[model samples]
Target: MKKNNSPFGIGGNKSTVSRREFLSKSFKATMATGIAMSGFPTILPASVFGKNAPSNRINIAAIGAGRISRGHDMPGVWQYDYAQLMAVCDLDSLRAEDGKKLINDYYTKRDGKPFDGVKAYTDYRELLQSKDIDAVLISTPDHTHAIIGVAAARAGKHIYMQKPASLTIKEGRIISDVVQKSGVKFQIGSQQRSSEQFRYAAELVRNGRIGELKTVYVGLPGDPSGGKKEEMPIPKNLNYDMWLAGTPEVYYTEERVHPQVGYGRPGWLRCEQFGAGMITGWGAHHIDSAHWGMGMERSGPVEVWCDKVDFATGGLWDVHGIFTTAAVYANGVKMIVSNEFQNGIKFEGTGGWIFVSRGDYQATSSDPTKPGPQAKKLDASNPKILQSVIGIKEFHFEISKEHHGNWLEAIRDNKSPIAPVEEAHRACSACLVHHIAMKLKRKLYWDPKKEEFKNDDEANKMLSRPQRNGYQVK
Candidate 1:
């Protein structure tokens, strides 16, 4: 891990009112004092009065300065004037520096001067120790998400984390519990929740536009079956041990981690040890949408099984390929997850069917698959369903066109965001259960309330894994 000489970056000074407490108490004192003395100025200092006051802005730190952080998370938060980019952290020193430069350059261009306040760190713990940071955007690999999330919650920092909330079911529960106890606002990066087409489809199902909501067809891309197995020297700037986190120690290779040259899609996305392939990678997004439509966002399937699975063998990349997993929720909604569908979610019910997708929108061009030529961004069996407007008395979900903005607003108001921590855990747990069922090649019963496999010790044992190298959750 990269060493830190000081918790506060460069010449930065710590504030007495930490960012964590600022949200809950900052405005209260000012309002209370103003009410008590009608003619007197508020308790807030003069510097905090302006619209762009530093005290009013949230100090956000980027935990993983990789592709998602640069391309999605940082850009999503920094563009808002209420949020400030304070620090960047990554296991790779090169990526950390790159992230710092990215944030600093943006401010320099905006202000028309050399602005260089963003700090770069190779260790996230040191960044968390600083009182200057109020919140964090975690875009780390799947293996490290739970550990970092648990740590960030304990440090009293609000979190906006990437999808596939945890590498294991047990880790998901642990992080969700910690975040609930911390009372810090948390949001999972399931951006589809903020999209119009997805929300409309989900609202349609919730309001009975699709009668009964019988089934959901979720399509996800699959990773290739091969990767170079030859071990390579660890790059000088990358900290391989820290990068591995709680996962098992393995030889360093460019194919095993990320490209040292650029921020292309990383190999770890296809590796089972790091992530459960596209099952959780893309499944997290589509499955979450399915749950939202079914009104089962906080619940999960009662059973899961997959008879058709192809686990890649004899290669560094061993995640599943071209598989189909069927999950039945307690509400009798059967969700079919497969790569054969057109890379989206389709809701089938008694009255009609509705489909929603990004429609040629790929977060990254390096993603393995795209929507077929016939795929549509939003569609329904009947034209009237697509044009129906939701009434105020009818079932309505939260409206958010901006995912990051919703998270920041929730932090400021101490309210739930569009995707809360518990819902994120449920979505990830469903994907993980599907993965386990695929591995065991059997039908497994699940108890959504208890969050475990029913009378299946062999399957339950796979819920959690051993942590090593000083990286462990709880």
Candidate 2:
């Protein structure tokens, strides 16, 4: 079958194959044969659904059961025939139970029988000790990512973690180093790498279709300035202390954590104590894509600074408001990240420009950030540029159709996923440095190789925050 033309260099020529189609065929072939192409894991009887052998399926445990987990992460893995969600853990008892029901209900309805094999726990430590779990899905807040990821790696289970890989640069490096040494398959939730438009945009630039890559523009939304500061009674179902992690202990407030009633967007996302606002929230996605296209996935900028930054005062939320951060790479490539541009990424070079955005693609509809124009998913200075074919001899990226599926495949094949630990750490480190520069309100020289600020003691101190008594990344 002839493929339709994709404006992002996916399909225009008859000889080209869409990455999605290629991956789909590969999956189908693997399922039909029930054989590991890498020749590991003894083949057993087929799965109950006949997708793959039961022994070949990966048993997954979800570590966070709140908004992102309930909405995106769990759904991404549960439906896959080669993956089974065996357990769920959360600091909140209510959320843990909710996750249990969510998984059991799906399996029960599909299997035409009661399925209650999914277990729920309030403590992640207990869940991690389970021998039945082969992997873990961590959709927790930004603050606890490194610690949980480190523990999960030591547990000898594969990891699929949500990005901004860590809350601090030091934490990111620590977790990445541990994961690499543990030799476990790790995939960060930088889903854009798996998207066709984003990958094609990177390909076009890397292949010199855009001439010399000069500057990349990444647009991310900022959280509004409103969160109640008044102390509220802690909910009985929540283990507030555990949720605090290494952050300073403070009175429980709805705005300081997640909603007690439903799985809406959590307020912690807007708090600086928990995250660096959208700079790391949506910035992780767009900036990581920016790095992929700029060929800086393993390396980062030589310098970073913010031209303007606004912080919300007199509220529980203190993350950056309207902001613009700039970075300069060793190769002289410049990157501008701000809330002003339409929500997406734009690559400009001497030859022309290419712009790629999610175009109404939100992980959850609850996300306030909306694409300015739906028609601009992919565009270039010349329409012919999008039609250019990337030859086999030229640089071609590893294709990934679905983020979670790629992780599972990596675990099976013992190979690196689309977004590996080192790349995720590097991309996140860029955002962290940008955040620090915004806070310092000055241009800071960075030593990417040493992963530290160059000859600046004041700025170097912010690389890692002090973790409270029990929550340190061990």
Candidate 3:
């Protein structure tokens, strides 16, 4: 790992090594161990004679079975043989039932047996307390991720939480600290890190194929502005009071409560209570890819500048809807993250610039000598590059499947996740810095070691928000 020299380095101690230095060392260690192990012959130990290893299936309790959980995490978890869905929990009874029925139907169709013993609950804490559950999947709103994740960790269960991992910078840090202390496996929902496409991109940057990345441009959709709206009666199945856990209470509104399926109205992204706007929403995934590629997952930018622009009335939300912001790292790397640009990421290195998005990967310079085949040939041994060279197909569902499988493997092997809590926290912290810059409308210097702004009390205060009386994130 790179040595962190910031005043607020890991474990609250200053270090001589830079963040890049620390990551480089860690990468070397990982490569040495992994490559060496790959060469070992596959032989059974004499201790077990010829018996096959026992199947260590992880029993998972899913907290907050909302739309994302149902559409993404649920299927991923059910499809993996290393894990089984033991229970489902959500504030909305209908959503919980929907998730339960889906899992049961899947198991019945796959194994030709009635899948019973799957419990459902409205309270996540109760679900976490179940002895049958060995791990938990948290797909709650942004505000409740830390609460449920921390509780699960304290209960001696591994966690799979959605991004952004925490609603605030301090909460993100606290989650990292708690997970470290607990010694439990914690995986953030930034599955892109485990995706072959993203991993190859990051490896290219790390292996110098991209030649000392100098700038990273990430295009996000936009921030939440809590646009003007009318209050509506709380839905019958949803416990509105429970849904407001860990957030400031606001009157229930149809737009904010239910996700829009088709055409009529917009979804909850317009509200500030449930999410961090698009910055924390989609930005969490794309910005995380940028950070991973830039080799800056352990630290963030030292300064941020906001370029505010008024939103046009009656338009769909975009990343720059709230405001546009640019962040500059201490290492001279510049990141322009706003909803204004087309959705994607660009890396400008000394040798050339490469652009990657959900759909395409190409270089700005097409010359063969500038950045063509030579760039692709930079790292022949790197697994990421080898995978790409061997023609690993790329698709969103495939990436999600691979990421979920990695998490399950990590649990069985007692290893860290592909996107561990600490790295995810740092990525989310970078996103939070953008939010702070937009709120202040100024370029602000940051002291990462202290986890605060350099001489700005007002900016520092934005690091965390006041928790509701019973929902503190401890």
lDDT of each: 0.88, 0.87, 0.70
Tens digits of per-residue lDDT, candidate 1, 231-339, equal 8999999989999999999999898999988899899998989999998999999999999898888889999999699989998899998899898998898999999
Candidate 1 matches the true fold with a TM-score of 0.91
| Best-performing candidate as measured by lDDT | 1
Looking at model 2, the pairs that clash are none
Per-residue CA lDDT of model 3 for 439-460, tens digit only, reads 7889999876678899999999
Query: Each prediction's Cα RMSD?
Result: 7.8, 7.3, 11.8
lDDT of 1 at 440: 97
Against the hidden reference, what TM-scores do the models get?
A: 0.91, 0.90, 0.78
Best-to-worst order by lDDT is: 1, 2, 3
lDDT of 3 at 384: 45
Quick one: best TM-score, which candidate?
1
| Better by TM-score, candidate 3 or 1 | 1
Residue 80 shift from truth in candidate 1, angstroms = 0.3
Can you tell me which runs of candidate 1 are displaced by over 4 Å? 1-48, 371-374
Global Cα lDDT for candidate 3:
0.70
